[model samples]
Target: MNKAQVVEAVVLAKKAKQLTWESIASTLGMSTVWVTSACLGMNSMPEQAAEKLCELLELPSEAKSVLMEYPTKAWSPAIPQDPLIYRLYEVVGVYGDTLKEVIQEKFGDGIMSAIDFSMEVEKQPDPKGDRVVITMNGKFLPYKAW
Candidate 1:
């Protein structure tokens, strides 16, 4: 089966089994963000992770192989259609520079490493409305100079 098919299968199994993404990630001993990304075909899992996923999801042999294969990062040029996704993109567009400047000021000539990052989605109680708190922690790597 194709990668997309595998994702569909896993999603179906998850639904059938009434499994939550958080639970799946916890069982895999990984972060929900990372595990969900891998299950959705955006990332590759190591062999053990893949095997565990296969067991948890009851994935076929083809899916196991597909899960371990490196993924091709592909996306449409058009802006995201989903409101939440578009809003996140807009936030980056508006605050990317300010964030960069502040990070540089605080940490030095460096950038946040997305490769070595962890993210969490939290719910904060608020008087008016509950706030969706997204926390991103990444390593800061300064530019190497000769």
Candidate 2:
């Protein structure tokens, strides 16, 4: 199976089993975000983890191989149309400059490394409405003057 097929199989199996990403991550001894990203074909799964996931999902052996393959990590340049996705894009559009300035001030001239990053999503209870909290932790790579 290819990456897209593997992703489809995984999603279908997960839904059929009524399994949450957190549960799958717990079973695999990995973070929820990382596990979900791997399953969604955004990241490559390690050999053992791929085998475990395939076994858990009752997927074909081909899926395990596909899952272990590194992804191209490409996306469309067009603006997203989905409401939730568009909102995130909007946030970056509005605050990207401010974020760059603040981060540069604190961390100097460099960028965050998505290759060595982790993220978590949490829910915060409030009287009026629930709050969504997203925490992203990425290693800061400072520019080296050569």
Candidate 3:
């Protein structure tokens, strides 16, 4: 498939799997909107971004190599002119309270930094519920001391 087609496929797969853009974007150290746009063919993936996308989607080596070539246009015509930040905001609208509680529980007072973080997922069996365990490690940056 072509670059746009590949991007579209990845985005569809992500949505089909019910994976959050924030989760994926945090792993890539990129804004959620950029990654979402890149995966939806709304924005071009630079060499590094393409590599990261390939890795995220587990694309084959050959397909990953092909994506590095510059495309004719930087973005697809179908993309809206308005910023995708609104879409991200919509996610917060749905889950903001739950996320805030979880974040506060995990890291105490501060927020998790997408910039300095890593994530790993593993399957764990449980009688109560089938579990998908996600572990995240981010550098904790305390607020400036007074």
Candidate 4:
């Protein structure tokens, strides 16, 4: 099975098993975000994790190999149309320059390394409305001055 097929199988298995990403991650001893990303075919899973995930999801053995394959990391160049995703794009568009300026001032001519990054999503309850909090942690990579 290819990554897309594996992803479809995983999603179906997850729904059929009534498993949450948190539960799956806990069983695999991995972070929820990372586990979800791997299952969704964004990141390659480690051999052990892939095996364990396949076992947990009752997926075919071939899925393990597909889960471990490195992704091409490509996406559509056009702006996403989904509201949630478009909101993220809008946030970046609005804050990109401000974040760039602040980060450069603090860390010099550098960029955050998404390759070495982690993110978490949390919920904060409020009387008005529940709030979603997202935290991203990434390594700062400085530009080579040569």
TM-score to native of every candidate shown: 0.91, 0.97, 0.42, 0.97
Candidate 2, 96-136: lDDT as tens digits: 99999999999999998999999999999999999999999
lDDT-wise, the better of 2 and 3 is 2
How badly does each model clash, as a count of residue pairs?
0, 0, 0, 0
lDDT of 4 by residue, 66-95 (tens): 999999888999999999999999999999
On lDDT, the stronger of 3 and 4 is 4
In lDDT terms, how accurate is model 1?
0.92
Q: In order, what lDDT does every prediction score? A: 0.92, 0.95, 0.67, 0.96
Give the TM-score (vs. native) of candidate 2.
0.97
1 against 3, candidate with superior lDDT? 1
RMSD of 2: 0.8
Clashing pairs in 4: none
Against the hidden true structure, what lDDT does model 3 obtain?
0.67
| Residue pairs in collision within model 2 | none
- Candidate order (lDDT): 4, 2, 1, 3
TM-score of predicted structure 3: 0.42
All-Cα superposition RMSD per candidate: 1.5, 0.8, 10.2, 0.8
lDDT of 1 by residue, 21-120 (tens): 9999999999998999999998988999999989998888778989988998788889998999999999999999999999999999989997898899
Give me candidate 4's TM-score against the actual structure.
Answer: 0.97
Candidate 3: segments with Cα more than 4 A from true spot = 65-146
